[model samples]
Target: MKVKIDLEKCYKAGECYYNHPELFKMGEDGFPVVLHEEISDESLIKHANEAIEVCPAVAISLED
Candidate 1:
């Protein structure tokens, strides 16, 4: 699976990076950047799901 963020729908809320620092980080422009685009780890998947739920803009998703 891969993590995909739709910047057009993202509001730069920082929820993903703040809650899951291991999987995401704040970019220089203040947007969240995915540390791992392709995820095979169960723990990372959990974090990604958590990020998706917490994102106010609903810009985060997982793709096969």
Candidate 2:
């Protein structure tokens, strides 16, 4: 799965970071940063989904 983050819509909520720190991180500007572009492994997908679900701003998504 391909993961994308809409930085413009992000409000620096940091939920993604809390849910999946390996896949998502906070930048120096306090915005969400995507650590990976694609997650094909099942284990990684689980973490990615967690990040998407926990994002309060709805800034994270799993794309085709």
Candidate 3:
């Protein structure tokens, strides 16, 4: 699965990047940035899911 973010739906809540720095980061424009586009690591995938769950804007998703 790959991590994808809908910038239009994002509210910059910082939950994704703050809690899962290994999978996400704060972008230059203050948006959440996906650090790893493709999630093949099992541990990382768990982190990704956590980020998705905590995103207030529901902007994060997984793409196959």
Candidate 4:
């Protein structure tokens, strides 16, 4: 699975970071930054999905 974050749509709310700190990072400007392009591990996929779900701006997406 591949995780993609639409930077333009992100509000920099930091929910993704709170959910998956290892997979997501916050930029200095406060936008969500994807740490990895692809998430193949099952455990990590769950966290990535949680990040997507928790994003208030609906900026995160998963592509499989």
For 1-64, candidate 3 gives per-residue lDDT tens digits of 9999999999898998888889888999999888875879899888888888888999999888
lDDT of each: 0.91, 0.83, 0.88, 0.85
Best of the candidates, lDDT: 1
Candidate 3 wrongly placed segments (more than 4 Å): none
Q: Is candidate 3 or candidate 4 better by lDDT?
A: 3
| Over 4 Å off, model 1 | none
Please report, as a residue range, the 10-residue window in candidate 1 with the lowest summed lDDT: 29-38
* Cα-based RMSD of candidate 1: 0.7
For candidate 4, give the lDDT of residue 43.
90
Better of 2 and 4 by lDDT: 4
Per-candidate clashes come to 0, 0, 0, 0
Local error of candidate 2 at 51, Å? Answer: 1.5
Off by over 4 Å in 2: none
lDDT of 1 by residue, 1-64 (tens): 9999999999899989988999899999888899985999998998899999999999999988
State the lDDT at 62 in candidate 1.
Answer: 93
- Estimate TM-scores for all models: 0.95, 0.86, 0.93, 0.88
For candidate 2, write residues 1-64 as lDDT tens digits: 7889898888888888877888878888998778887778898888888878778888888987
